[model samples]
Target chain A: MKILVCISNVPDTTTKITFSLDGKAFNTAGVQFVINPYDEYALTRAIELKEAQGGSVTVLNVGEADTEPNIRKALAIGADDAIRVNLKPTDAFLVSQQIAHYAQEGGYDLILMGRESIDYNGFQVHGMVGELLGIPTIAPAIKLDVNGSTATLEREIEGGKEIIEASLPLVVSAQQPMAEPRIPNMRGIMTARTKPLKVVEPVGQDAKTSVQNYELPPAKSGVKMIDAENAGDLIKLLRNEAKVL
Target chain B: MSVLVVIECANGEVKKSSLEAASYGSKVAAALGTSATAVAIGDVQANALASLGEQGITKVLLDNDSRLHDFVAAAYVKVISKAAESENSSVIVLSNSNIGAAIGSRLAVKLGASLATNVVALPQINGSSFTVRRGVFSGKALSDVELSSDKKIIAVKKNAVDIETTAGGTATVENFSADLADADFATAPKETIRQSGDILLTEADLVVSGGRGLKGPENWHLIEDLAKTLGAATACSKPVADVGWRPHHEHVGQTGITVSPNLYIAVGISGAIQHLAGVNSSKVIVVINKDPEAPFFKAADYGIVGDATEIVPKLIEAAKALDK
Candidate 1:
């Protein structure tokens, strides 16, 4: 079995979001980048599956050169190789198209990705890729297990989870309960240098969606501390003052 | 061309989010100086279909297929595609839900329409170019995206549009069918195992959620009772699931299920950005934390600085009283 895991480099979860001077782009000043937290579950799960059945895991990302470090980090963790589609991912459609183009020829048995990229939270790429490639997609899957040519997954639904069975050549967007992410060990870090990091020029696809502008949300107001013992007063304030109750 | 809205129904009643989608579609149609039509699927009553007129839907195309009652992605895509084609819809609107996201993408490809999911606002249409603001970075940031395609498909985030009630309105419901083939149910669900909860998180108007601060799984009764009284569903933060205090299915975070109910009450939860990403779309957020400095209060509409043990019971009482 061969697996392809897609990852996105995003700002750390704790970073304060700020926009550029013209409010057209994310301000990168003094920002630290990390692998999208949701994608980590997908990467780790793919590596685990590969280890269990003797296969190769390839990591893919569509981003500029600055995202290479995170791509290498995925290699360090467990991916056998990496592919970088050299372009800025302007929208979910273009990103999904780029990924589908690569997976189209790669003959990957399983294509896995985060349920949604933390940066965009579009939650559309997996379905789009599945649609583009004409394959089945089980999204936001919490449990995934493969047996020979068949893969079983538990997809999260509203009140409960659904157990789905699909063939090998399928797409899965993973969330928690799949596997806990593993940090790179010393041996893994050293071996990462020898791993192949392939950079491919993007196949042309127009980004139907473009960023018009960006703005930071309004700063939160100061805390109005009601006495802890007087909890009822807080409820009253919610009904009368805030009028949200 | 008219705007097309997909209305989902189950057990003979329309889902709340689809009504919100209908209202949203009507506004978009109004913006474009046209009418909005609805395509109804599943076991929906004709009377209920006509009631969509309250949201300004002028006509409803009802497809009463038993196989469509449960979510069959391929059949839904085929039916919706036919509806869009027949109506010559330039824009299609749907709820940003599991069904919507699943079927919307395939329809986008079949119809060659630009697709946007988790959309939080109405489109800013400027001479054929449509732009929408969507929540990103797990509720930590926002992005304004322009859908450049001539045909656009939008999955509106739940609770983003207000549910409007306009009196003395009725829509003409007409029977329609796509003549789906047997192969359309290829990926149909073999079984559906609903959890033992009174209200589903997506359908619930109110939700009572807990986090690691609840200490252990044994204390979940308080949250459950409150939810039972209020007819809300129960949820937990990722940390609770990570620590085995709750099941993984109960986790709500960037990596978990994103829900948008009318009211969300968090008990003993310190708001993590990932967790906030899921529930930030709720209309009203009430945070109850012993710690005065919990980050959840920053986004909460109401905050009570008290122990969950003390506050939750009182809240349940207040809710019970309202029923009387």
Candidate 2:
């Protein structure tokens, strides 16, 4: 079995978000980049599958050279190799097109990625890639198990979950509870240095949508601290003062 | 060209988010000098279909296929695409739900349309250039995006738009057929497990959440009681879920469910930036913590510095009194 896992390099969760002076681009200075948390679940699950099924797992990223450290980290986590579609990802459409272009020729049995990137939060890439490749795409999958050529998945919906079955050559987007992400140990870190990291030029059209500007959410007002004894008054405040009850 | 709104229903009821989407679509249609048409998915009752007129929808298209009762993305895409093509729709609106995201992306590709999800507001239409504001970076900031395609798809975020009800209006319902093929149902679910006997966290407008300060799962009744009194859903911080004090589904944070409810009440929780990222879009926030300096207070509109165990019961009593 050949499994392909896609990863995105996103800012660390705790970083304060800020845009450039012109507000057209995200400010990157002093920001620590990490593999998107959701993608970590995808990568770990792919590695687990490869370990059980005797297959090779390849990590793919559609980003510029600045994303390499995280790509190499994915290799350290257990991927056999890495492929970087050299480009600065601007939108979901272009990223999906680039992923589809590469996976079409790899003929991998499974393709996986995060449900959504933390930055864009579009949650559109997996479905688009599946449509482009003409395959079944299951998203927000919390549990996955492969048996022979069939894969069983638990996909989360609004208030429930569905147990789904699909054949090989499927696209899936991982959500949390899928797997606890694994960190690179000393041995894995040493081996990752020798792992093949191939960087290829991007093959895709321009992004369908362009950012005009960015604005920070309005600052919240100061809290109205009610005395502990007057806790009941807080209810009145929520219902009348805040008008949210 | 007309605007098409995708209405998601379950057990014969339209979802609250879908209602907001319908309202948003109709306003957009009014701006374009056209009426909004809805394509209904899932098991919807006739009354619910007709009631869409309250949200400014003038017409509803129903496929009435049993296969659609359970969400099959391929079948849904086919149904929606057929509706859009027949109606000559240039703008499509749907809720930024899991199912909506699944269908919107595929539909965008199939129709060669540009798509935007997590949209917070209506498009600022300037001739051929339509720009929309959407939440990005997990509610930390917003970005304006220009969709440069002939056809545009917008997935409205939950609680971003109000559900406007126009009085005493009824939508004309029409039968729609997509001639769905067997292949469309090939990936259909084998079984489904639904949460029972509790309000859904994602759909709730009022939420009461607890954290490690709640002590343990044994003390969860305090959270549940407050939630019950307020008719809200129960949620938890990431640490609570990670330690198995709460189910993962109830976890609300950057890596968990991102909720934009009308009111979010956090008890005994310090607001990490990650946790705040999941809920900063809330219309109002209230924090109850023993520590006065918990970060959540900075983001909250009202706060009480005390042990949640003692404060929650009093608040619950006060809430019940208000109902009386």
Candidate 3:
């Protein structure tokens, strides 16, 4: 089994988000970048599958040179090798196009990634890639298990879960509870330094959408702190003041 | 050029978010000086489809395919694609749902359209320049994106748009078929397990959420008591789910469900920035924590500094009294 797991570089979940002066892009100065939390579920799950089934797992990323450290981190976690398409992903369409171009050539039996990246939060790539490759795609899956030639998944729907079965050569997007993400230990970190990290040029495609500008969400007014014993007052406030009842 | 709205139905009725999408789509059609046509999927009554006129939709196309009763992404893409083509639709609107995102991305590729999810507002179409405001960075910020394609697909966020009521007449319902093939249903679900609850988190106007402050799963009755009294949905912070105190579906945070209910009450959870990112869009926020310095109080509109065990039961009693 050859599995290709896709990862994305995003700011640490606790970081205060700020855009550049022009508001066209996210600022990188003094900011720590980590593998998108959701993608970690995918990467770790792929590694677990490879360990059990005796196969190789390759991690892929579509980003510029700045995203390498996190790509290396994936290798340290357990991927056999890595591939980075050197391009700043502007939109989901271009990013999906890049992944489809590579996955078609790699001929991996299973391709997995997070349900959505934290930055843009497009939630579009898995389906786009599946469409581009003419394959089946199951998304936001909370559980996945592979049998001889088929894979069973528990996918999240609105207010429910669906049990799905698909053949090999399919795409699945990871969400919470798929698998616990593993941290890189000292031994894994030492060996990852020598693992193959291939950087390739991006394929050509025009991004269909472009960011014009970004605006921060408005700040909240100060809170009205009611006393602990007066918890019942909060109900009246929600009903009469907020009018939300 | 007509605008097409994809209406998702369950239990033979249209979803509230789908009604908001219909409202948004009808307004977009009016902005473009065209009519808005809806294509209903799933088990929907013809009368329910006709009621879409309340949201300004003028026509409804009902597809009674049994294969579409359960969501199949490819089949849905085909159905919407054929509807768009037949109606000459340039803009397609849907709810930012699991089903919507699954098909929106594929349809963008299949129809050469620009796809935008989590859209918060209608497009500002100024001569060929179509710009839309969408929530980004997990609702911490908003971005204006320009869709340069001739075709555009938008997934409207829940509760972002008010349902329009000016279009009062019943929509003309028409029978439609996409002539779907067996291959389109290749990935149909084997079984579906629906969550049982009085109110779904995404559709709820008020939510009562718990955190580690409750101490253990044994104390969850406080959260449920308050939720039941107020008739609100129940949610939990990520740690509670991680520790197995609650199910993953009840988790709400940066990597979990993002909801924008009218009122959000966080109990015993410190306001982590990650948790706030999922819920800052809420109209009114209330935090109940024993600690005075919990970060969530800063974002909340109202707060009570108290122990969950002591304060929650009182709140439930108060809510019960108010209901009378």
List RMSD in Å for every model shown: 2.1, 0.8, 1.0
**Taking the tens digit of each residue's C-alpha lDDT, what string does model 1 give over A84-161?**
999899888889889999998798999999888777877888888988898888877888999999988888765667
**Residue pairs of candidate 1 with colliding backbone atoms:** none
TM-score of each prediction: 0.94, 0.99, 0.99
Docking class of 1: medium
i-RMS of candidate 2: 0.7
All candidates: DockQ: 0.57, 0.91, 0.89
User: What tens digits encode model 2's per-residue C-alpha lDDT throughout A131-192?
Assistant: 99999899989999999899999999989899999998899999989999998999999999
Per-residue CA lDDT of model 1 for B92-197, tens digit only, reads 9999887888888778777778888878888898887788887776766677888888899999888777887798789999999999998777666667777873
Model 3 achieves a DockQ score of 0.89
> What count of clashes does model 3 give?
0
User: What DockQ class does candidate 3 belong to?
Assistant: high
Can you rank all candidates by DockQ, best first?
2, 3, 1
Q: Which sections of candidate 2 miss by over 4 Å? A: none
Better of 1 and 3 by TM-score: 3
Error of model 3, residue A123, in angstroms: 0.3
The pairs that clash in candidate 3 are none
- Chain B TM-score for all candidates, comma-separated: 0.94, 0.99, 0.98
Candidate 3, A1-245: lDDT as tens digits: 99999999998888899998888878778889999998999999999998999899999999999999998899999999999999998999999999999999899999999999888999999999999999989998999999988999999998899999999999999999999999999888999999999999899777999999998998998999999878899999989999988
Interface RMSD of each: 2.3, 0.7, 0.7
